[model samples]
Target chain A: MTERQDCASLLVQHLGWIERVAASLSRRNGLSGDEAEDFASWAKAKLVEDDYAVLRKFRGESALTTYLTVVLTMLYRDYRVAQWGRWRPSAAAKRRGPAAVRLETLVYRDGYRWRQAADLMHSRGETDLSEDELGKLLADLPAGSRGRPRQVGEAAMAAITDGADAEAGVHAAEAEQERQALGTALARAMQGLNDEDRAILRMRFWQGYSVADVARAMRLDQKPLYRRIDRLLSRLRTELEKAGISRERVRVLTDEDAA
Target chain B: MKGRIDDAERLAALLEGRVTDGERAALLAELARSDDGLEILGDAAAVTRELEEEDRAAGVLPIRAPRPGARPRLSARTGALLAAGIAGLLLAPLAWRAGRIPQGSYAMNLSRRVAVAGKGLPPGVGSAPRTSVRGADDGLSPGARAVRLGARQVDLHLARIAGDAAAAGAASRDAARLLHAVAGAGTAAAVYERAAAPAGEAVADRDLEAADANAERLAGTAAVRLGAWCEAARFAATRRDAAFFRDTRREVAELAATRGLPSGAGPALGDLRTVLDGGGPVDWAGLRTRLDVLLGAAGG
Candidate 1:
């Protein structure tokens, strides 16, 4: 066979690893294979362009496979950041096509559950997962939290069987949350806490802790406890900057409210 | 800045259970500082609050371990009391074990398993734990300290054939150990728990009721199955294992039986049988190819 065939064969042989890397990036960062393929092709192009000089030296440092894995990973990260910067607004853009568009719509606008499931499956390709396992994971999703709310089990089975284009659906859904992005306000609101305060805040607003229980547990007398709560609110207000959420949104609820 | 107050001392006194009314007032005033300092103090208080909330929510919280600086300051008498408390908590597993039945087939010989499983214990242990070396019974690998805890063909093969009791029982203890090894190799616990259902049945209540008998039964059964597989793998490797499996020897072994056949076929075949039998190298690609061929053949 020709050199091209040899290279192609080698590429085909390691296709699983290459795909695994792609799937992992998709899962972790919600990148599609088009995005994944772009990163990989760029890495390979760079590695091969310079007369195989860097690639040869890389061969000596680690096994060719290991070196390729590292280089591909680094290149993907750098290329992704660069690509991301180049098309900032289009970061949430989904390509045309029923499958891809649907995936993007589901992830971005429909429900966090399908996006999360797809993200997990994408992130963990052939990762000790069986169809049954994925099915079970879908079934176990918070009892009543299906995106379809209309479908369960077999209907949900479409997610996997139709998955050839289902991933396009993931890409589509990813574009949905573009409207309400994680921004500076949320980031700042999260600041100024030692790990403990952060944990408490998480337990409180996010986790929905009640004031009375929190006060009692912290061993604070009510007056002093009220003061601390005030300080937390003030800090949160300063941090939110204008995340559209207000002090009223910062809830400390009883178990009844939590339920 | 305002005059520095030794609130640390006041808090230390409070922590020491000697909080005077005067000291309590002073500590509260200092804790109410604003901006960054207040934030830091608030964070500390909040962390303490979180710890408490975690206690209430979780129903139990890990004890506050004293930092190194505070260690020597602990009164020896208090230290002794603390040590006793530590001992009681540390031995909670022993207390827990005393009351409960061993849950699964792959019972970690507590002492032996602990010696190897350094750090990141299942739930409760006092001492530092580490991943221990695979024992002789755990099976050895070809190279120097090649104690690889990779996926067992048996487990994968059994999991694929769910509801098959014969395969499940013969492979239960081995499958569980394979999972133990896989979990050691960083497989998620959910996978094992799912596998454990079938594995539980494999080594039934009656089997485990007699510990020595159970161990002997598993050891002997695994030895036979593994011996057959291992021997088959070795011979196929040397172009002999396949020979035996086919109920024929090298005298009539096919040309394909020769090692290093084209497309790495013969060697790959060796890999397939090796993995299928007792413990062997993880030739993932070879196994996949074998499956593909078998799948194709069956389809045809």
Candidate 2:
């Protein structure tokens, strides 16, 4: 074969690798099947457009496959940032707070179950996620709590059918208000803590660091560290209670960090 | 500006596990002081996660292994029949050479039966079946084709073993075995070219399977031949039996040359020279283990 023909054959072989990289990028960016195919085709066209200049310039510093992977990854990341640039999360998701996009990506795109995704997120330093908190983020409310309204409706039909609609609306409204108030109180109390204290809280709760790790990192004796942690929780409880958060709500919030 | 760029590079290095202890301490100190430090760490972490995610998505997955108890796609009964057929073909040459079977009857009956059965035709007179017979003068009977292919397989196995032995400096026994197998292969190749020369239709599965068995037997035969040659070479070298070495070398070289073998007298000649000059290191146990592995893979 002539040099051109040999180069063409080499390019043909790399087409499969390029397509695979493009497909991965598409999947990462949550593109549909057709979009993924289009992305792959585009990547192939770009590689070959100027007489395979990109391939010709390959210096053999790394394996051709590895070089292509890094190139494709950078291209894909650039494309995604140019297109989306943190515009993915809606106001509601933003209100749901930090790592919401990551949570969704893990649960939906990566196909991780909620708890596993939550653990991964925490490990990656999004440390505020308690297991129950993560579950709530995924709308995996406690079975009885989420299902209680339906049970109440069934009982209302058996006894107070006429007043059922009004009673149910009032109860749901009250519950929503309480939930919102609890979220606000927690957020405010968390923000009120100094940066060092917040970091300690994260290390202790979010990251699931052992008490020993926390003490070592904080340069405190284990006994003093434990006492300091206890005092911090007590202060949070008082602050939340002042803002009308019930003791039960505070207990629920603190329960996740008991480990 | 330089300090921020340094910090960014340090953070990237930290994520990639290239950060030094002092840099790690500095990065940790920065992280503890402010939210901006935390944001830098989070972004670095996110980039690391993305790279990992891409790798998982794009990495070549391992080929699923063949399950245990996986036999050839051909049934066990079919394999057994093939083995039997190959055994008959292979034995014909040896038996005839030994004067155990009448050559005339063996050739006429076995050839006619193999041809007819192989073509899936009745033994009735038909000119059309004659056209299906590939090599009239030197063409292989169906049985001969099986034997020939099996012999070729044996030759290949011997070559591989010989190569391995040479590599491991166990060249003496392996070289002799290889020379024997090469000669055998030349004969087998000639038999196959004359007897089996690509008849228009695909060779039947039974014939192919029989050939596989024949190849294994041929390899075994080659191994036996190697042992005999090793003994002969050792005797010739140790006793200064120049006449024996001269004769054996000529025979091996002549057969190899006729077969268009690249290493005409190379290995056998080299092994003889080694033994005669001053014996070289021969890892006999290692060579045996290697042969066992090869034979085991070949279903010997």
Candidate 3:
């Protein structure tokens, strides 16, 4: 087929992914039913418009799904930002800083870690603040920011283009089961975490903040922040391993970039 | 700094391109030793990628324009006039060669031209009565054009079914049955999952079961229609009698009315009839797309 046709076909194949991701994002943000459907449809149209020229520009540095996820997430974020006019952490979350510290701004703009947000507070006279203190400051911001896990089951089904094929069917079912198991394990692991560890991990994975952002937010230097992340991952791995999921398997599943 | 950087901060620094060469090497050595460490880094890498994307996307991408030299918008009246002009141009040569318009060729070409012009005409404007095609005053030796048109329409309908042979066959399979043929099992599963979700208002087991049964019925009906429409279209195409196509159209229109499609059914049905009656050339691409979309959405 010609290049244009190939691109169009590729866009069609990934419509499910676009829908799932859009639905996932919309649901996370509390949009439902028709709202969610509209958001997803709009996202699909964007990807498919101009004969899929958007997808045709892919440089192929990362997995196409990951690229799509990133693109959709950014679009969703931008949409919310536009609608609400620049999200800031709750104005009511009292802090020691002279200027109100929006967790998103701290992490996204200044590349500060969650701990660095505390440092910003500490420098303003909230000295010797505990990690829990920092957690309380950012807790009110949102559930999905800074690496909050998205519910992707329906969205994952969108990736299954050929449900009639036995092999694709098995893979889809297995993937669904795996996702459910991981979700359960993740919940259990989160429960085992102290508030500070939970907040840190949430900022790191769920919010998808850079370590530097989290570090800058929480006011810790990069070194201890990295150690904290490694320790948290180790602890989660240990919890999952105890729950009968192997470390190797966890590694494989977490590698979402693997096709 | 020169040795293995065991500290998480140093590794994070190295990942962010803030580390010296020695610190980078040390982190690489540490990652090779610890698989978990590597996994964490991978997670961090994904995070870094998202951050980069966020930075690059200052705002949503701009909308693009349609390609230059795209087809001009032709209104139905304008299109009819243009088609008439083309038909006149082609017919002029034949008329000139005969020293006058030949009776058979003139009638045949006029019928063809009428069909083309009718495509752009509104349904009420130039549409012949449903039964009129059989006795319409076209100069054709009766039923000849109807037969050819029917045959061509049937070929197109058969091809549409052949294109989806796998999905159509699979509709009878367990997985396909799990979802409706149009929505597939994926949509059915979605409906089931939504119904069964415990966090929402408690839906009764009986209600869930009824919904499932309803979904099954819809899927079954749609699947049957998928096959039935193809077969019917094939029959109408080969029957070669204008009356057959007209009657079949009326039959489906009645079915559509009973189902209460409310808006699209009448127009689409009307459009199909117009094409079948040789009002305009069959837009096979447009027909195939419409059929797939309509059948896919068909629950009733």
Q: Of the candidates shown, which would achieve the greatest DockQ relative to the real structure?
A: 2
**Residue ranges of candidate 1 with Cα displaced over 4 Å:** A1-21, A27-30, A37-76, A82-234, A238-259, B1-100, B103-300
Lowest summed lDDT across 10 adjacent residues in model 2 chain A is found at A141-150
State the fnat of candidate 1 relative to the true structure: 0.00
TM-scores of the models, in the order given: 0.27, 0.27, 0.24
**Which has the higher TM-score value, candidate number 1 or candidate number 2?**
2
Q: Give a tens-digit lDDT track for model 3, residues B246-281.
A: 334645555454542323334555555556556533
Error of 1 at A120 (Å): 22
lDDT (10s digit) by residue, model 2, range A64-180? 443455455445544544544432322223233345545665565445778888888777665487878777766722221111122235654677555658889999999899989
How displaced is residue A33 in candidate 1, in Å? 4.6
lDDT of 1 at A230: 60
Model 3 chain B poorest 10 in a row by lDDT:
B117-126
Model 3 bad stretches (over 4 Å): A88-202, A205-227, A230-259, B1-300
Q: Please tell me which model should have the higher DockQ, number 1 or number 2.
A: 2
Q: Which candidate leads in TM-score?
A: 2
Residue B222 lDDT, candidate 3, scale 0-100:
26
